[model samples]
Target: MPPSGPPTRPPTDDAGARADAYATAPLLNCLLREVAQPLDGTDEPRVYRLPSGERLLRVRGVRRPARPEVSVDGDWRPVGHAELVKLVAEELQAHTGLSNPELPAEMTDSRDAVAALLTARDGATSPEDPYRRSEQSLLTGHPYHPAPKARGGGPVARWLPYAPEAYAAFPLALLGVREDAVAEEGDVSALDAFGTAPPGYRLLPAHPWQLDLVGPGLTEAFADGRLIRLGTTTSDTWPTAAIRTLYAPEHDLFVKFSLDVRITNDVRRLWRHDLLSLRRTDSVVAAAAAALRTPGAWLSDRGYRTADFAFEELAVLVRDGLHDHLVPGATPLLAAALVEDFDGTLPAGLRDPDAWWTAYLGAVVPPALELFARSGVVVEAHLQNCVIAVDAAGTPVQALFRDAEGVKLLPEVSRAAGWERLVYCLVVNHLVEIAEALRESHPGLDPWPAVRGVFAHESHRLDLPEAAALLSAPTLPGKTNLLLRWTGANGADARYLPLWNPLAG
Candidate 1:
């Protein structure tokens, strides 16, 4: 046992074993958190019962559950990815009284995708830039999603070149929509730098992978000269963890595209409605971000361009880069990256872990709560949406938030509902994951008290009633990803179950 109790690290160095461990942890977390009933006070291997106690499952480790086993023939038999997927399907179908053939396949596909990524990553070079490396480090994408890495069940070859985990860098496929057929809004001038259009066309850059996916359907448009291929960008755009969005380091801009494939809960597309409402939502959140006394910024979604004929399919969004927003000398790393793995990016000895975490809480927590209380803007402060800038001493000094599409505005959503969402995103999804990661690294160090201190301070500082209520609340709303997928609910229709609040006293 390696001090933190029975070793959380895998028993073997085998690639498949590592991949299985990486892939299994998230599924096991979802199974245990959302569906499984804990048989607390049970000995060594922690145990949980399925919805009806018909099946007993147990796993080692708490933060990232591992070596899942089912009690069979009065003995615990370890289960692999396939067996686990089948087990999950059986339990979900029995519990929900619904059969989801798609989710199970996605679960299997996700495991296979992880296997492919693990193999590709072994021989691939990690990005030289620290920020880019941090962004690409998420081999395990969402800690709670059942299939966080499912790449549409497509072949590895089709998806590997664009995967950030593989340190992918490729130019955007430039296209020219006939000037009269172009649909554009806001400032898409950044797209003009990639390549020139013909005399009567406007520049529109598309994700090459998305182009391949939508290519077959574009035969008619190509034949009619509504769209023309204009080669590729001279500079390569690196895909961020949100695979559809790519960062053009040379141009200092972010270009997000419409990916038809489903990632996690939704089809990763620049949706038509979301595109239409971008300005309204982003402007509100941006204003709140700008008003912050704390070190924080919102990477604005500047504008978008697409073919009027294929509105949603080829739509591309232009977003602000970090050059203008980042603190003078501070490096802005993806917040998700911190929880995933630092990969030796941070200098270790500058600050004690607790002090570093306190600085982090101050930098990240205030902005979301202030925005929610004063401006009625609920920024999705989830791990992926945040970029925390650590000073030279590895202390968090600033936070930059992005993805305007995810921000929810006040009057449009009821106050009660908005507050619920803010708590779920900022506290449960974002803080809890990062806190757990921090705790795992330095065992016996409790992080929640500092979190409680931050919340208490914010509640008093902002005079927000919701913040006070949060500390005393017995349970926090946890998004039911596994059940949501199994029930085939709309991605936007979030259903939550109570997760015992860590801050509860």
Candidate 2:
């Protein structure tokens, strides 16, 4: 399939205007969802009141909110992306009675990053492969993040060559760690396939950008022969939506690296604590996926390799490839791409909303619910986490789930907390966006009844008390991302607010 009309490259003469709109949508969504309260507005543009300051706010668009206006001196004034950041900061400080200098800068950085991505796209060639297009199509990044595209305030030149948004693919930087300092776990034989190491060293492929980020810090290691640069691999690995993770098609394997840059909620590092327990978590998730009666698959984080001195910074994780798990002849598409209306790839000219939604629901819902019901595992099946495979006709046939770091097992956390996260990730984060995107085109279509039906069926089949409870609950847990960031809470420490349940009767 040819590459889709990249949403980042609009026909508009002003690239800044396109970048501003792209960046502003998700920021407004975060502000509106987390902090603002709805007001009775008898007008075209919806109005809201920022609860802490009693400031009147108005916004346009349903899915990704845009064209924000705040009332001043009895007149509504349009707020640009920068002004929106300031406005959000002021409202958040008053609302929480806390100060945060970092979030505002991150917000500005996110907008700047979009401008860079837009500029890069003009010169860069988009990948022709359907899967690659789907992976790189997330121009808006996250639907409800204050600064989803923020690249840790780094230079564009440093990250552009490695960015999936720019359809970038490059050979892995091969490093040889002295065997004594080589820290590893589980099956990491896949690393040997990339390139050979020196006489007393083992191969550890690193994300080139990550290597540069931590290179200066590893001066002593290089000096002491603990680490040695063995140059780059022969094959090129294309970056996935998760910037740190890469897919090498020649090997049909995924290699995840730790980059100290913050993307969205947290610093995207493969922490030592997490790596220590990676095997245990991945095994359970794999088993859970195995127990599923439907066509579900889990891309396991098979093993990891890093240096003892700089474990977290230099860590590289090996993940299972799509070839092993996906249905024969089916193409895997990122779930996030489905949420973007202009992604221009799969389901763009989708007809028969009822049938398509049914296929999608069949492909996605069963795996998430059944995994929890049978094995007490929450797979964090959000848009980024889920992968939907479609038949040649562009009809979804299977769902594959990944990222063991995000998975939570029962008894590790309370059943209530796990269930809330499952609902948020699966329903609120994953399904809601896709449903809304579908509704935007097929206006009269109602996806809720089908969703409720699936829930009704699965809950009854598995006798899941939480799923049954959700059928009648007044609200679903909506994560407080904007507030959480503003208050300097841990990204994993999810705090949720109530959203009116569409699943409820």
Candidate 3:
């Protein structure tokens, strides 16, 4: 005290004491010297430029709040740095046969070292439940009210053009009867079918659009607790049309028919009426097959078969667990049911316009670039074809793509649909929808930084660096020109008037 010019006193509370300790604690900087470099490949700080033009970096020091909004006494609050180190130490000992009972005290105590271990673990392990349904159990079952889908068994029903015109069309085939002894209908609800499938078939939930076209069949199926219907599918928004859910009673199997036909004239026009456009959906099926072939995919299906669907080839998959199954991928995201209007009233995390931009550019955009490079095809990976499943940790895991019809393989790249519709669908519609959802959920969250994180995280998986270049690219503020905004545009900047879809309105 006598020697010092000023007096410094530490706070009495535990929080203040902890903070003070953190400031002076010696850190090995292992993250800088070892982990971050190998993971990131460069010394460049993980800095991202915000759309507002400010540069932001990862929240340094202190780290994300240690406390969640709510916590229970027994909950395994995110494995702390010390605990994480212990876990890593155990894993290393098991893998390397290095009996390291203790992670050198220097490493064990380092928070950065723990973080690096977590990062490496993330890269190495593919978590089982990608959709994070375990956290939000509310979304585990049907988003809508459960419908009893069991119906009285009978001969195969006729394929009516419209629900109202049911009597005109002749039966496509016997309801439970099959010409071949191999094919038989099962006694199970539509939900049961989705959970399990027969040896030569797959059952998937029909898209909302497909449900609307078939009118009450889907709702009725849901109500009856068991019934399957077939009809042509509709648009890029949903692809449930012409999809069928067939069950086999004797084999206790469920089969869903997948088609390559577009149900709408709009989608047909968008792709110039080429069957190659169907490749998007086809590619998804193909990718799943390829992924399954790799032991790493960890898929349960025994195998898949290619069958004819309206003159085009559609894939039929057979897997166990029709009644008791866990998709781990589809269950969670669909539960949230993103609200689709621009009321400017979405959540704080999603409301920020910048957040939307970042997600599209960072996470969604790079994959398109990678796909273009690998297959020579730029796919239209819009919302309809893509299923974004979030995990218990609230991280988006796998982006499951379905409905191969929207896919386009270029002639030069393979000549298909060129870049017109592909660009419009992937870049415009799909990206915009995700952006809108993000903006609505986290209004205050910055979009660009999120996108950067996505790009940084995902791009590291690909072989090509060029695909990641777009992460730093700027995005134009999006403007819609539906009929609602039309008259307003004439009052000011006439060029920007139409803001609403006239037909939809």
Clashes, model 3: 72
lDDT of 1 by residue, 1-505 (tens): 0001111233244667777888899999998888888887997589888875677998888878898889855688889988999899989888988898999899888888887877777766667687887788888999999999999989889999999887899999999899999988888898898888889999999999999999999999999999999999898999998999999999899999999899999999888999999987887888888888777789999889999989999999999999999888887788887776656433222237788889999999998888888899888899888988877666788888899998888899999999999899998898998788777777767889999999999999999989998999999999989988999999889889999999985
Model 1 accuracy (lDDT, Cα): 0.86
Per-residue C-alpha lDDT of model 3 across residues 69-156, encoded as one tens digit per residue: 1113323233334543343344334434455432223233223322222233223322233121121111111111011010111111
The predicted structure with the larger lDDT, 2 or 3, is: 2
Between candidates 1 and 2, the lDDT winner: 2
**Quick one: best lDDT, which candidate?**
2
Ranking by TM-score: 2, 1, 3
Q: Candidate 3: what lDDT? A: 0.30
Q: Rank the candidates by lDDT, best first.
A: 2, 1, 3
Off by over 4 Å in 2: 1-12, 41-43, 52-54
Worst 10 residues of 2 by lDDT: 1-10
Q: Give the poorly placed runs of model 1, Cα more than 4 Å off.
A: 1-13, 344-351
Which residue pairs clash in candidate 1? none
Candidate lDDT (C-alpha), each:
0.86, 0.88, 0.30
